[model samples]
Target: MPLPYSEKVMEHFRQPRNVGRIEDADAKSIEGSPACGDMVAVYLKVDRESLRIDDIKFESYGCASNIATGSIITELAKGKTLEEAKHITWKQASEALGGLPPIKTHCSILAVDGLRAAIENYEERHGLIREHKPTTIEVIRKRLKRVMNPMVGLDLVRTKVVKDIEIADGVVRVAIDLPADHQFAANIREEISEKIQPLWDVQKIVVEFTE
Candidate 1:
């Protein structure tokens, strides 16, 4: 049987609306990692006078959950003022989809983070905010260097299994590779979540595995 998915997830995944690009977009932002298996790019046409997102489009390369999330986020942000759109959180995206499987929670984060990054860029260029933004994944290793696999007793970084990590929109996602039948998969996720949750903006942590 296929993995169980909520009706909303299937709806968005099967027929993702706003599935392309916005040309000469007033603001654009992209997040996720190609090497680790997902990337999301968002483009927006903003009404400068009203500071509202007039139009939005996205291109995504990832699993079904990621695609669904990209679709839902656009639907949520479209026509909303920039301030309102900027406040769109991962929780709202997942809630709209009736919640995701724990493993798929990261996809929602990817969706919202992409939106925030684009808006942040737009704001910076418009002189709404003035702070340097790192164009790459920021400090993944330093934060979770101590997260260990209970069975192997090897920290994630030292084990070299952390293919990619992304943290934003109050969510943390770490993708790793392990044996398909690894017994402690859930344990790994729980332990890592425990260690990182307190320190980061992480309201949720997704420990995804590639077998």
Candidate 2:
């Protein structure tokens, strides 16, 4: 039997870089979930004067690809200015590791998202963030695309699991096409909340199922 991963992927999995948390990290963000078995927490130490990522680290809870992606992204982001690091996409991270299986591509998404989220946190805390426009259904739907369905490893939007979306009075309501008792239902619901809860204009999130 042969491994599906590239040599670079295997190398990073065996010896992932920056594999721990920073005690006083300037900014940190956790993405994915335990239920999905693919969570990653990214920590960043930025040079405020230069707005550069002085150091970066990650802790991952997932498979080989997940660990490998996390390692590669941290390596790629280190020493880059936040503006530059924010341009580190999942595809770029995957290519850096030779490439990942299509099924495992979501791992790279999680890794890149974790890094970008940490950068966003740093910017928000340092008042470097831009003023967000009013949140709308399109904004909510776009964010939902990042919420992967654990069953297929694809986002809710792409999998067509998201049936509908609505917002009123600062509350966002999402209707997903899954049985309320489906095994992955809880995971999906939690993923949706994580993705939508960060909207500046969203005061609350409501996820409901529609079989």
Candidate 3:
């Protein structure tokens, strides 16, 4: 069978742009994990006056799709203002690359996530982020959608693996429908914490397995 990837995907994978770290970056983020066999790191240098991304780069540890997505995402975010870059989506990244396989769609998601996280970090550092809003279960669930299940290369929320979510008094509890000893259980838990821990109002996080 022919390769499933498009020509754009192959080209980017072969010579991914911005494939290193920016040691004095204005902001940076690293997402994904070795357990998933995929990780992406993003760094940015923003023009504080214009709030534009003066420079952007990425380092990816994963498949061809992962590297390609990272390359395309940085190209899309560079020269854009923080507000504009925040709107860059995984679909846009995949489309820019001509498209990715259905099974590898999460690669785009991971790449876009790294970009957004870096932007958020910059905003937080420069006091551009808005004041804290009340945390809700719905918000928590929405964020959980970004936590992919390594076994399936799909998010836990989309796969219906997030059995329950509860929040009260600054504490958030999440119940995942996986065996406690499952190979990716710890990785999933860590991803869940990373997603929720950023909330200003979330003082604690508790993840439990419900197998």
Candidate 4:
């Protein structure tokens, strides 16, 4: 209730536009994690001849920042060329919403990631173009970077609270080091868990917290 949110963010959340899916979406992608308690799905309808995004929609699962980011991302992407839309970074998305709170930065990342993922999914599924995909660890870091602390305005990994990440046989192990008075340990663990759940190779996730 006391979270810092820009007016643009509140406006979008209060009246999120393009909240559904496109039946014949040219590109569709789901990103983020339920364990982290934020997830986003993007759908794009492109013009066949021009390769411009004619329409776009999204499905968001999370808090106000999540829904607002998803809404703003779609609005920004619509009517742009696929390449242009794919290049829309999370920072731009956040800026379009008049800048998101530090804690909500990751929400913008998830929104932009969802859109780019949809584009990549479209290209791969259609045999249009092939690109270098992120390794599992890179993917994990990207997700973790968005799991920012509300109080600190930095991600757990960047703040060194999340010390290490390990993966073996589709199971992920996370190591967390927090000050004893840290108020968000449980929530942080849940966020990290949710972020990795969508990874194809990730079957299970275990979080360990330390002093």
Best by lDDT: 3
Q: What lDDT tens digits, residue by residue, belong to model 4 across residues 54-155?
A: 999999998899899999888888899888887888888888888877856666677887888788777766666755453376677777776755456556
Task: Pick the TM-score winner.
Answer: 3
lDDT of 2 by residue, 38-90 (tens): 99999999998999999999999999999999999999999999999999988
Total clashing pairs in model 1: 0
Per-residue lDDT of 143-187 in model 3, one digit per residue for the tens?
898788888877889999888899989999999999999988888
Q: Model 4, residue 204: what's the lDDT?
A: 88
| Best-to-worst ranking by TM-score | 3, 2, 4, 1
Better of 3 and 4 by lDDT: 3
CA lDDT of 118 in candidate 1?
83
Residue-wise lDDT of candidate 1 within 96-135, one digit each (tens)? 9888888776656767778887887788668776453432
**Alpha-carbon lDDT of model 4:** 0.79
Where model 4 places Cα greater than 4 Å from the true spot, the runs are 1-3, 130-211
Candidate closer to the true structure by lDDT (higher is better), 1 or 3:
3
Give the backbone clash total of model 2: 0
C-alpha TM-score for every candidate: 0.63, 0.93, 0.94, 0.65
What's the residue-level lDDT of 48 in candidate 2? 89
